[model samples]
Target: MSLAPILNPAQSGRAGVPCSVVGASCLLAAASLLAPAIAADTVRDRDKAAIRAAAQAYQEALSRGDGPALAAFWTADGDIVDEQGNTLAGRKSAADATKPAAGTVRPDMRIRETNLRFLTDDVAIEDGTVEVGLPGIAQPVRGRFSATWVRGADGWKLAALREDRLDAPSDAETLQDLDWMVGEWTVVEDREGRPEAAAGDKPAMEITVRWNANRTFLLRDMKIPAAAADEANQAGTLNVTQRIGWDPLSRKIRSWVFSSDGGHGEAAWSRDGDAWVARTAAVLPDGTQTSSLNIYSFDGKDRCIWRSLPTHVGGEHAPAFTMVMTRKPKGKTP
Candidate 1:
């Protein structure tokens, strides 16, 4: 994931900004209640900037693997308590504890400050999220950290710091990203509101997508006129049943498809920004194997476009095509 700054640079320092600290309840009383909040917040902003700058300094020290510099950020008797309940007490102990990481590959550290409030004029409490990008790890290690900063002659220092690891979402829960597919839809002309195909064109395909009883999976049933597709290449009504669910072994969202004819296939789904990409592999009744990459792009709440790239069948290639699907009205008929 891309990294964001601790805070936007434009947010700090309200110096020279115009403000009318006046209200209906007398000017003096209103000023008394409002001016201090603005003043206190300004002070907090300066403190936050100082701490942020100090954090950057420590980041540089970490890159150099300088254990002493890292220890200097804490007070002489500072305490670092980890999620496992282990403690690194005092500046010396902290320095010694980090000796192992010295001269070794260090992970990239990122901080996102959430809330900061001054306990007193010289001390403040901070809460934020921290992510460390470790070597050999595809995803960063994410966690929440709370730290108490004490202001001494040397400026703000970490007095006590604690962090806890966050749990990753389950595969089933991750499937919720495609929730918009659950609905009734029918193929329509890509140019206009409804189907207006030229005479003798392939018939529209009607589809209904819904959730299973427990809502863990989605089931989609669709129909295509024999003119569009038929089993055994014969003229007969063609129907397709598709089941979409999370695959735990592969850790991906996958769909299994079965047509009226003796053919079956499955596709693994992935998202690329606003569009979904499905890598599909199928087998026909005649033992011919096929593969294609299908892209689904939603136009709006009630419209979507499904486009299939070139397909490789046994030894031949099928041209690509695009089709628009519009959600059918709640109570409508063909």
Candidate 2:
């Protein structure tokens, strides 16, 4: 039996093998043909392992000021990012950023690695903190850093690096007109009374407002805190949407605020004897209907505060909630 001849390109026209005798050789040849595929998988695994190992070593070299060692691990087009979100690209750029930081060392400084995610066999993302000491500075510079790596023909290179200052996550707030409610504020005092206590007596929520160029199309966002939130309703959030505009037909101001949750109501605002008064009405979550008369005025210091008195069933007055919001410093809070 000459099954081998079937696979040999140069041995065309060779006599065919006996079927019974060729079975063993046929199996062996099939296995031989599959050897390259299996070997290829092994090679891929080895390459990935090597890349990971190189990345780890490179990181260690940066920490220890092994410039030459670190440089050897990166591809020619590698990039680096500082903790302040500054980026330096290419081998030269990376070298410059690393070289200066590498020269300084302080025993009290702390550097920690946090998260590493592999997007693919050839791409990865790493995030961590870099704390370096300064000569006279009381505290070390601490910020987060991230790197995007790609496996190139020569080796693994950084495709991009983004560094951003690390800060505590801020409560959301409206950024622009129609920006919608997005910041944290609490109801410190309610003079008119509480219809029912907002999830918290403090009644903290976000306020957002949007306006168009004509100023006629104005939208407002109010978030209601969750009932169970004792600490200013950090967990549960409810939204209130309102639209305000001038009606040419009526020649007056018209607006409505609807609790996106269950409270739906309209508020009409106009000048009172000495200030602005707004009348509001909406249904509560428990199927109770109520109406509100709110008076707003600016104090001697020009701080705005609102008094809200709500009436329900047969015009019976009850205290629901009062809201006083201090103007945030121009650029202090996030």
Candidate 3:
């Protein structure tokens, strides 16, 4: 008789299923994985609801002129940075700043979300604009606002907030630095190979240099004298003054070249090893492009020499170019 084989308790379960003690542990682990997935979904839903509710409450508080209510949405140590990058930190300052607008003017402020960026499960950034009607202001003064929010057990609270005035610089102003170029100097240029000039006219033009208030920036105010036939147009020779200084931001020397003929140009100077190099970009009267480059080397005896590249505009290398100056002697000022 073909009788059914007695089922073995451990091995009789299913095909490919392990029957050893390790198998039970594996089965148990597989079942436990569902708990975390369920928990994650629940937490995500709650966080979403909390963020929405908190954002709505904050908006309402601002429109209602509720100082305490508005403050409630922010953390105790929250900070505010204005458009000019000036920061007002802590609840006290933030509260005080808000009070000005929350006063009797009765603002119709709205906080609609223009952008929402989540940094983590607990941190987020909200960007929008605030429009208010101040007394005597014809149009509404609208400024962009950004606030950082943090998650809490109750909901999301603002941790830091900042706003900016789009049309102007910040209240904090940065002073210019140019303290390395205070001295007297003279420029000597030699112009040759030009058919328009008489013999021995190939070289030599003179210029004056000065610096203001012990500044690093040296101003090159140069004058070009005209010859006998050109004396009638002597007033039209070259009158250019460049305010040169070092820019800490760009880590390069910069200059603003202003001409007496109502023209202007910008220049940048940087050092490559022992050589100082400069490139100038200028606009001509007819809106044409003019450029030049110079490489400078200083001798041990306080003399600076510059070699002009092959492209000058109207005076020297090509047209109006090249500069060299000797450090002035002591006790005599230029």
Candidate 4:
């Protein structure tokens, strides 16, 4: 007697079916069933990429101050809930609210995606950080934003956007206003067309700014190799260690800088139009008191021009000089 399980012809509606034939049929059925699932996964991944692209477009529009372009990222009836709880309903309202005044400095806004979840093939939820600042603003506005994106005939559009202001910025949050400076930068003295370059070898300054482990402060280290070679002057190799942080007591952004040459100074930083103005006072190693106004203007993410106007130094005022710094690519040694 063969001890094999018999196939029920009544269940399969086929009689006298070979086991091999049954196995092949089952495999074919599974392939047919999985094909649609595989196709669906591919479609979902494409949709996610499209949605993220739309988010980037939205940020670019904001940075360009193009209110219409910004609005086009949203659905016709889309709504925006701002940090103050004011709602701008519909595309027109949202666009008008965001339109910059004539001649106003464009806000430098950056968006970083934190989370993205697909609710359906055509719908998704995105959470991100939005940091915005104008040239003269002491600190950029930092906020959290959550958006609902929906896919339609025209691709993904924001169905709703809600922004919430972060509680009074932590020490780290304020430092984030200068986050663009968190990198290695080099100043090529001769290339900058400055009069100081007429002197031999024109000193080059390398600056490195980095965040501490907790990111509460930005540590800046600046080195001028030429300064060290000046044997006659004790200022040996100008190395300055600086820390930038938010001072809660003063409710201001400040920086303290100490140089290897026994020079120490502090600056209160503020925004002035499209520039950052730092009013600085320092005591030189020779015990001479000095004061200056330093203005920093960013040309873009990688380059900034800094100008210093001396107000007092040895009781003599001096002309302002400008220095430009360009960011060095990561992992590149100066």
Candidate 5:
């Protein structure tokens, strides 16, 4: 995301009046008019940074099980609202609630700032995502948090904090469940033959999955080399990109796919027992609509199986097919 430059109103003048004239009284007036706004902006930026640092410090304290240190980041009268909608008033109460039990391991926590809105130079509202990983839990617990920050002699301090546990799984948690698939994988064997292979085309397929820089989305890319002359003259080959993320509006795990062959798809994913399923609908270049249910099962970290049940295509149903995928050997090139 690119931000537009913050223009100085003093230098830009007001109401189309020119302030560049030599010894112009209008220039002084413009400068006077803009001084408070400029100062406020500067203070807001500085406070935002301070509040973020304070949040990070609190996270560290939590990781280390330092209840006192966590309390130090808050104002003397700061309060906290826990996920269960219970309020712990006063910094001491908040600190006591954060303290880990004796001989217990502290949960690892990571915070990502999402928004900061300044109501005044001395106060601001902060929103962030919190990910917590506890011992014996397969996946981290994801939640959202909001805090009211105040500027005092010690700089920004959390005056009030509220945490809410998500009733539905977050995109990060959903993606993390599939993190085992983050690697290069190849189709080692196909119990059912590929569609192109049945047409006497020995096409090759490769798949790679990785996380975006912020680990907010899983990006999967697949490529199949053309095995026929007619297909070669078209798009370089069969290339598809899939992005898996949490859809806030749908409140579900969703994916969008785009292909070089002018095909695109949208899928809503769900978990069934040990397998993950994606119900997908795609539109082809020729305006044909196709729908399929794809089931993905994991054998282990290195092996998985995929089954595609084509339920509808141009008003016709197709048989289901399955394929096995094995993680590419480490240090091996394709």
Candidate 6:
């Protein structure tokens, strides 16, 4: 019987072969050619899933600066070649990398653009870039890497890692986000049209912001008219000078603030959506420590809102205050 009717029973109603022998042979040959071949040398599907799990764990450990945990991701004799041509092997390979070197702050490694291929059932190769979020250095560094991952009795482990090139982006470009803050601003009514300068809450504030000569720092001078909010402002018109700049060592935008009444503090600035939040850690003239969250958000080019939410002040909870700030008219003096 011709194989055509047997293979494709609906081709003809007759049970016996209805096609010619040559046609049956051609159909059989075509079906054979379309058959999938399972290669023994290729990676198993389960193994690929395991490798992905290990990669995720690897990134998590590296970010938290957990040295011992990072070391566990590698094989017993695994090694790494850094961008500088230095080689480290075994536990030292993972442990040493997590240690923040000089000029680096919290060098967190994140693998990106990963391409994984199986060399064999038990071995895989991965090519990607490792972006290190090292805050203290001025330049942002990205290192291209090729890693060898091997499936072992326990699980997948990194057998070798090589970082060949390092690319860096200019640090100044990162500071451009704050350019909108460089202007003179004075207090306005709150966002809800409520006055923030209520009794015993906050004084009226006017701030003039300008860029330093190098354009690397923001110079802000604030004048507060004497009010009942604090003893310092009640004595006279309080002047507060603050210099905000990018600190390469800390990998943060840092500000140093000094008040006319001898109160001084520093804050690390970070972005939260459309707002900039500064967590200030300050000490009063009488040696009392205080901390507050200062949030600055914008409505447009000419107006913004500032909120001082107190977390701690002399071991008591002080009321949080909010105010709207309008940009002063050009060439106008207060």
lDDT, residue 50, model 1: 95
For each of the candidates, the C-alpha root-mean-square deviation to the true structure, in angstroms, is: 23.9, 22.4, 21.7, 18.4, 23.5, 15.1
Misplaced by over 4 Å in model 3 are 1-182, 190-203, 214-216, 227-237, 310-324, 328-334
What's the C-alpha lDDT at position 116 in model 5? Answer: 91
Which residues of candidate 1, in runs, are more than 4 Å off? 1-173, 189-202, 230-232, 311-316
**CA lDDT, candidate 3, residue 311:** 21
Model 6: lDDT to the true structure: 0.65
What is the per-residue lDDT of model 4 for residues 110-153, given as tens digits with 9 covering 90 to 100?
66557899988788999888665534346665668888999889
Which regions of candidate 2 fall more than 4 Å away from where they truly are? Answer: 1-187, 190-203, 227-235, 285-287, 300-302, 316-320, 332-334
What's the lDDT for candidate 3? Answer: 0.53
For every model shown, the clashing-pair count is: 0, 18, 21, 5, 0, 2
The runs of at least 3 residues in candidate 5 whose Cα sits more than 4 Å from the true structure, single-residue gaps closed, are: 1-173, 192-203, 228-236, 312-319
Tell me, by lDDT, which candidate is best. Answer: 4
lDDT of 1 by residue, 171-234 (tens): 5446778788878887743432223552234435888888999877889998887766644495
The window of 10 residues in a row where model 5 has the poorest summed lDDT is 310-319
Q: lDDT (CA) for every model shown?
A: 0.64, 0.50, 0.53, 0.67, 0.65, 0.65
TM-score of 2: 0.36
TM-scores of all predicted structures: 0.44, 0.36, 0.36, 0.44, 0.43, 0.45
Q: Return the lDDT, model 2, position 44.
A: 66
lDDT of 4 at 260: 88
Per-residue lDDT of model 3, residues 1-334, tens digit only: 4322323444636444435544677778987998898888798678767776777776565444355666667787887654434344435432322332211333345554567767887998878766644322234445677778898876688888767543332222222322223355554542242223322333244445566666566777765555411365455566778888766675456778876656687766644434454555566454544444555655545555555542210111122323455566767744
Q: Candidate 6 at 155: error in angstroms?
A: 46
Indicate the residue-level lDDT of 8 in model 1: 28
